[model samples]
Target: MGIVRIGQTEITYDLRRSSTASERRITVTPGHVEVVALTSDDEAEIDAFLTRKRQWLFNALRELETTTAKRAVVLRFMTGSKIPYRGRMARLTVHRHGGPHIEISYRNGFLVDLPSWVGEEDQDAVVSSEIKLWLKRRVRRDVLEIASSYGRRFGLKPRSIRVADMKTGWGACGPAGSILINWTLVFAPKAVLEYVVVHELAHLSVRSHGPDFWMYMAKLMPDFARSKGWLDQNQGSMNADLFTSTRPIIDAT
Candidate 1:
């Protein structure tokens, strides 16, 4: 129902108002700080768990606070702040009510003059939606073209293509011909994104991320190391930016 202090730890929870389940489950996430009840009947067990996890809860809260601060910084960058494009960080130009358009173009060797029709507060949503639409169209087209080329080259064919906002991985292919591409991959560089497509498509033949996977990926992309570096350097920001969804951009795909 509220925060209670056990020794030096402070735990916050909400009492049931219209709960339907009877199990108690605690989740610690950067976007939220609370103990949730899966079932109301397990309140006692929850209390016990809180007692045992008091130190862990406190540490988790501290870590969550840090994560929140980092996300705030990223949101600030996404919202009307200058950010790097390719290798250069450019100032964002916000323009509202021109024609409902968003574009990134170069001026004076800088990426400048984004459509200001969207407000500063709606930048993340606007950018994400635009990029997502862009990605869907681009990814589908590229995946089809790439897969077709590779299918012919390697004698393999992918059954289907799908996009998801996966948190832990860029792309994966299941043995059953299912392929999941992370939506955030759209924010990455063209080369890096292509590498991901090639990587996943390669899995159509070799489902495991082993020597064979590397061998195949290397065959497809000899310079994949650069793409991996791009992902490692930029994934945190990309993942952080994906969750701040408030508005929808027209799907370009």
Candidate 2:
């Protein structure tokens, strides 16, 4: 690991050599930063590349820190803890019942009932699992319907729409017309979620994010830029993975 100073912020990042990398790239996750460069590159060359992008690194680090702070409340998985659901905060209530199965339900809040035999250390994991399952069901019941309505309005029909835990992005559209949307989006406002659906559907008509694509998106959703900006600012707080170990179920390809 190496430390780089970007303005007033000091970033500690790990450097990884990738044989297939043609150019250096920087990735910022929830915790730290990563620099990926060609295996043949030396330390000095990497440092020079980082120096050139100091401003960008500094801004990203600030945004990440702000996002993490906003999400700290939901990260704790205990009774009375709050989690986001449909743009609102839902309180969690854990109950121990005499059964081998764990049951979860949601209304204004989440009710989790686990087997009495389950240890305290394991309850958090069980709660996360149950919440994920509930989110998946909501995706099937609600998000798909919303996506279809937008698709119809845009005269675009995707071959399939699947919900999964997309870590790096909100949604993706394949050449074959398959659309994969992140299930975590359930926590976002309805307008933001619609923006992502429309964005992916627009991809069906234009593969590249060129001027023509923006034109199409503007015609479909005039205020799309606002929704995109909202996602950029609040996405960190909406990350369900911060509380669980579930991976995205669909392949983007």
lDDT tens digits, residue span 17-70, model 1:
227544444545433345554454466766675666666666766766766665
Residue 142 of model 2: what lDDT? Answer: 70
Error of 1 at 184 (Å): 0.9
Candidate 2 residue-wise lDDT, 105-223, digit = tens: 88789988888998864666778877878877886667688777876776788899888877689999987999999888888877888888889989989889999999999998999
Strongest candidate by lDDT: 2
Kindly report which residue stretches of model 2 are placed more than 4 angstroms away from their true locations once superposed. 1-75, 245-253
Q: What overall lDDT goes with each candidate model?
A: 0.60, 0.78
lDDT of 2 at 56: 77
